[model samples]
Target: MTTPNNGDTVTIDYTLKRGDGEVVGSTQEVGPQQVQLGAGQTFPQIEQALTGMEVGENKVIAIDCANAFGPRNDQLVIDIPRANLPPEPAPQPGMALQAQQPDGTPMTLYVVEVGEEQIKADGNHPLAGEDITFDLTLRDIKQAA
Candidate 1:
């Protein structure tokens, strides 16, 4: 009955859902997610919840938007001329586009509105501004090397 501790590697099966019950993500349909505790690999709140939990332990935790993905920043929403976009694939609402920042860092921009002249792109995470719940099951724990 070894309890998980900081620096340990742990595997978990989880379903992430919005407050309204929409499933955002889940490992149950695929495989357990493996992460290193205290290594910033997963959400801090999730790490905190798993602290001291033994193998096979399960719990449900709720996290607010600020603690999860942070609030949506309106400044991240911008309108870019349609001419600036690539000609292929034809941009449409709901499409995710990969873009580089002024600093050359990569980021994802979601298409919010498509227009003849300009398209609106939102850089906020899809789940931003929403509270989420995680049904987590600790499947295994490996001690840190």
Candidate 2:
């Protein structure tokens, strides 16, 4: 069996879980996910883990918070005036909002707290500060032609 190479397009079924074993996400429920190795399409650690994998191979890998989604950034949490938010939806805790970075790139923010005059939004990823485990099954690999 040929092992996956750096430029190969690999398909895998994966279940991602938190350190506490709570299911965070899974490809098993929605089918396999395809990734182009070395293309930065998936997590670097996951790609590294798949380096020597062959079709039908299964493995479990654990990644630290820093290597995965990264540690929570305190600087990303900000309080925005409620008047600045769109009036239609009425921002509430647990709501997701989009904002632009200083470089004009889009950033996602989660409403962490809603107050009478201000809304606290966190731009950190939902999974930030989490140690994740991935249960991976290599389903297919297409070598670069």
Candidate 3:
């Protein structure tokens, strides 16, 4: 069996879990993912691990907080005046809202609290500060043509 190398297109089935074992992401629903190794399509660590493997090989990878999503920033937790939010739909906790950064870049903010005067939203990724795990299975690999 040929092993995967840089620039090789690889098909893999993967499930991502948080440190608490919470299932965060998986390819089961959408099917396997195709990524070209060393192309930055996936995490560098994961790509390194996929460097050598045969088809149908299964491996579990543990990524630290720094490498996974990086540490959470407390400053990202901000409270916005309720008056600034839309009055029709109303904002609630656990809602994902689209917002823009000072640089005009689009971002997703998660609602953490809904108060009478303000709504607390977090700009940090939900998985930030958590060490994550990846369960990966190599399905196929094609050498770069």
Top of the candidates by TM-score = 1
Distance from true location, Cα of 132 in model 2, Å: 1.0
**Predictions in order: lDDT:** 0.92, 0.93, 0.93
The parts of candidate 3 lying over 4 Å away from their true place are none
Rank order (by TM-score, best first): 1, 2, 3
RMSD to native for every prediction?
1.4, 1.6, 1.7
lDDT tens string, model 3, 1-145? Answer: 6899999999999999999999989998899999999899888889998997888999999999999889999999999999988896889888998999999999899999999999999999999999999999999999998
lDDT winner between 1 and 3, please give it. 3
Please tell me which model should have the higher TM-score, number 1 or number 3.
1
Clashing pairs in 3: none
Cα deviation in Å at residue 41, candidate 2? 1.2
Where does candidate 1 clash, by residue pair?
Answer: none
lDDT of 2 by residue, 14-99 (tens): 99999899997999678899999999998888899898998899999999999889999999999999999888799988899999
Kindly give the number of clashing pairs for every candidate: 0, 0, 0
TM-score of each: 0.92, 0.90, 0.89
